[model samples]
Target: MNLFSEIRGLVLDALAQMQSDGALPEGLSFVNVAVEPPRDAAHGDMATNAAMVLAKPAKMKPRDIADVLAGKLATDERITSAEVAGPGFLNLRLAPAVWQGVLAAVLEKDTDYGRSAMGQGQKVNVEYVSANPTGPLHVGHTRGAVFGDALASLLAYSGHDVTREYYINDGGAQVDVLARSAYERYREANGLSPEIAEGLYPGDYLIPIGEALKEKYGDSLIDKPESEWLEELREFSTEAMMDLIRADLKALGVEMDVFFSEKSLYGTGRIEAALKSLTDKGLIYEGVLEPPKGKKPEDWEPREQTLFKSTEHGDDVDRPVKKSDGSWTYFAPDIAYHYDKVTRGFDALIDVFGADHGGYVKRMKAAVSALSDGTVSLDIKLTQLVKLWKNGEPFKMSKRAGNFVTLRDVVDQVGPDVTRFVMLTRKNDAPLDFDFDKVLEQSRENPVFYVQYAHARVMSVLRRAAEAGIAADDATLTEADLGKIDHASELTVAKKLAEWPRLVEIAARTNEPHRVAFYLYELAGDFHALWNKGNDETQLRFIQDGDVATSQSKIALARAVSVVISAGLGILGVTPAQEMR
Candidate 1:
C-alpha cells in the first residue's frame, strides 16, 4: 500500500469534513494539495501542504486552516500527531503500528511491493541502442542500452505493456563501409595481402566474418568485381555485427523484443507510405529551403527540395525529407520508422538516443506528432556520454572494436550486475564516469556495492536464523507479531520502506530510472544504519538471544528491507546479491 497516498486521502477527507461542518468554504479544489515526506526527518514522518494550497482559494489564512485541519487529522488513529509547523504546513508523526504495517505489507508483497498500476497497461514502444550494425556496440551504446532496458522494465512494473526494440542502421553508407572492410578481411583470409582502406571499418571483429565468407564462397567471389560481392557482403557482415552486438547486450542482461532493420524501410515502399500519410494532411511540400541560420555550411545554397512543415507541429524550422538531388535524406527513414510504430497502435513511443542526437529530438517528436495526429505521445531520452577510467587514468579503447571501448570491455571488467547498477547511478541525461577501480571497491561510495551489501546482509541474517533453527521465511515473517518491532531505529527502516511505492510511481512518471537507483541507495543506508545500531543495543539486533519470538519480529523488518531492495533492483535489471563474496 502507498502510505503517503493513504495519508493524503486522510487529509482530503478531513478537508471535506471541514467543509461539511461549515468550518471551511464549499467547492475548494484539492488538486494542489500534496502529502510527502518532510524535508527534514526531524520535522515529522510526513508533511502536507493541504492548508497552504487551500488558504488563498478559501479566502482564509493558512495558519487558521492548518489549525483546523490539524485537529481533524489528530482524531485519526494512524496519525499520532499532526502539528502545524511554519506558517501553515502540517507535519505528521504516524503511530508505530502504521510503520509496522508497512513492514508487514512488504513481507506480504515481497518483490511485488512497489509494483504499480500507473501505466494501466498502455502500450509503450521503447526503442534504444539502435546503433549501426557495422560494429560492436561501444561504451556510448552501453549507457543507452542499460537506460532503455531499465526504463522498459520500470514501465512494465508500473503496468505498461512495454516493447523493447532496436532499430538497426543497415540501410546506410556505414553498412557499405562494413562490407568493404569485411571484403578486405576476406582477402587476408584467402592468403592475399589485403588493402586496409582508410574509410572502411578496421576492427579485428570482421576477421571472422571474412574467414566465414572465404569458407562459404571459396575463390568464386575473389576475382569478381565490387558490384557482385558488395551487396552480399553487406547483408552478411551486418548480420555478423548484429550477432556481436547481441552477445554484448546479453552479457549485460539486455534483451530486445524487436530488432527492426532500417533497410526494410527502403525497398518495402514503407518510406513512400509514411510520406503519403503526411502528404494527405498537407504537411509534405515541394519548396526551396533556406541556408541554416548563423554560421552556415560551406556548401550552403538555396535549392528546391521536398520538405515537411515540421515547424507547424513543434520544430524550429521546416525540415527536408528529400534532398535537391531527388534522393531521400537521412531523416526520411527515421520518419518512416516512427510512422510504422504509430500504426502499430502503441499508445506511446520512447526513443533512447545518444546525447549527440540532441539536435534531432524536436524534429523527430514533431514527425511523430504529425503522423499520429497527436494521438500517441513520443518521449525521446538522450543518454549522455560515459567516460571510462582505470588506474586513475582514462581507459583505453578496445582493439576488438578498433577505436572505441565496446560494451563487453566494461561488462568484462565488472560483471553484469555491477555494470547495470553503475550505469543507472546517474540520470540518463547526465554524463557518467565509470571507474573500474571504484566500482569494484566495496564501500559506501560505490552505490552498486552499497545497495547489494544491504541485500546480502539481510540474507546473512536469514541464514543465521535458519542455522539457529528459527523460522524466518517470508510466510513466517508475515505471521510475526510485528508490534514487537517498536524500536525507533527499526521503525526508521519501515518508514523508508513505505516510500518505495511512491518513489516507483514518481520515477515512472518522470521516465527516470536513476531515481530508483537513488532510492535503493537511500533504503540501503537506512537499513545499514539500523544494522549498525544493533551492535551496541542488544534489543535492536535482528536475532535476540533466547527469544525466537522477538527475533522473528525484528527479523521480519530486515526481510522486508530485502523484499523492497530486490524489487527496486529488479526494476533496474539488477539481481540482488544473495551473499557478498
Candidate 2:
C-alpha cells in the first residue's frame, strides 16, 4: 500500500471538510498539495504542504489553515499527531500500527508489493543498445544495455506494455567495410596471406566468420571481383556479427523483443513514406543551411538540400533529410525508424543512446514530435561513458574486440548480476568508474555486494529459524503477532519498507531506474543497520531463542525485507543472492 498517498488523501479530505464547514474559502484547488517524508526524520513521519498551498487560495493565513487542518487530521485513527513545524508545513506522526501494517502489506503482496499502475498499460517502445552489427558490443553499449533493460523492466513493473527494441545499423558503408574485412578472413582461411587493411576490421573475431564462409562457398568465389560477392558477403557478415552480439547480450542476460534492421527502411518505400508524411505537413522543404559557426569555406560548403523544419517542433535548427546530390542523409533512416514506431501506435517512446550521440537528441525528439503530432511523447536518455579500472590501473583493450573491451570481457571477469548492479550505481548521464577490484571486494563500498549481503543475511535468519522449528514460513509469518515488534530499531526498518510503493512510483515517473538501485542500496543499509543492532540488543534479535511466538513476529519483518529486495533486484535484472560465497 502507498502510505504516502493514503496520508495525502486524508489531508485532502480534511481540506475538503474545511471548505464545506466554511472554515476556509470554497473552490480552492488542492492539486498542488503534496504529502511526503519530511526532509529530516526527527520532525515526523511525513510532511505536507496542504496548508501552505491552500492559504492564499482560501484567503486565510497558513498558520490558521494548518491549525484547523491539524485538528481535523487528529480525529483520524492513523494519524497520532499533526503539528505545524515551520510557517505552514504540517508534520504528521503516523500511529505505530500504521508502520506495522506496512510490514504486513509487504508480506501479503510479496514481490508485487511495490508494483505500480501508473502507466495504466500504456504501450511504450524502448529502443536501446542499437550498436552497429559490425562487431561485438563494447563497454559503452553495455551501459546502454543495462540502463535500457532496467528501464524496460521498471516500466513493465509500473504497468506499461513495453517493447524492448534494438535497431541494427546495417544499411551503411560500415557493413560494406565488414564484407571486405570478411573477404580477407576468408582468404586467410584458404591459406592465403590476407592483407589486413588499415580501414578494415582487423579483429581476430572475424576468423570464424571467414572459416564459415570457406565451408559454405568452398573456394568457388575465391578470386571473384568485388561485384560478384560483395552483396552476398555483406549480408553474411552482418548476420554473423549480429549472432555474436546476441550471444554477448545473452551472456549478460539481455534479450530484445524486436531487432529492427536499418536495411528494411531502405528499398521498401518506408523512408519515402516517412519523408512524405513530413512533406504533407509542410515540414519538408528544400533550403540552404547556414555554414556552421566555427567552420571555414574550406571545411564546409553550404548547399541547397532537402531539409526537415525541425526547428518548428523543438530543435535548435532545421535538420537536413537529403543532401544536395539527392542522396538521403544519415538522419533520413533514423527518421523513418522513429516514424515506424510512431505509426505502430505506441503511446510513448524512449531511446537509450550513448553520450556521443548527445547532439542528435533534440532533432530526434523533434522528428518524433512532428511525426506523432504531439500525441506520443519521446525521451532520449544518453548513457555516459564507463571507464574500466583494474588493479589500480586502466584496464587494457580486448584482443577479441580489437580496439575496445567487449561486453563479454567485463561479464567474464564479474558475473552478470554484479555487472548489472554496478553499472547502475551511478546516474546514466554521469560517468561511472567501474573498478574490477573494488566491485568484488565484499565491502560496504561495493553496493552490489552490500545489497546481496542483506538478502543473504535474511535467508540465513530463515534457515536458523527453520532449524529452531519456529515455523518461519510466509504463511506463519503473516499470522504472527507483529505488535511484538515494538523496538525502535525494528520500526525503522518497517518505516523504510513503507516507502517502497512511493519510491517505485517516483522512480517510474522520472524514467530513472538508477533511483531504484539507489533505493535498494539505502534499504539494504537500513536492514543491515537493524541486523547489526540486534547484535547488541538481545531482544531485537530475530530468532529470540526459545520464544517461538516472538521470534515469528520478528522473522516476519526480516522475510518482508527479502521480498522487497527480490522485487527490486528483479527490476535490475539481478538475482537476489540467497547465500554469500
Which 10-residue window in model 2 sums to the lowest lDDT? Answer: 293-302
lDDT of each: 0.93, 0.94
> For residues 452-560, what per-residue lDDT tens digits would candidate 1 score against the true structure?
9999999999999999999998898899999998878888889999999999999999899999999999999999999998898988999998999999999999999
TM-score of each: 0.98, 0.99
Candidate 2 lDDT, tens digit per residue, 1-581? 88999999999999899888989887788889999989999999999998888888777889999999999999999999999978889999988899999989999989999899989999999999999988999999999999999999999999999999999999999999999999999999999988988999989899999999999998887889999999999999999999999999999999999999999998999999999999999999999999776766776876899999999999999999999988999999999999999999999999999999999999999999999999999999999999999999999999987899989999999999999999999999999999999999898999999999999999999999878888988988999999987888888899988998998898888899999899999999999999998899899889998899999999999999999999999999999999999
Candidate 2: misplaced stretches above 4 Å? none
Pairs that clash in candidate 2 = none
Q: Return the lDDT, model 1, position 316.
A: 97
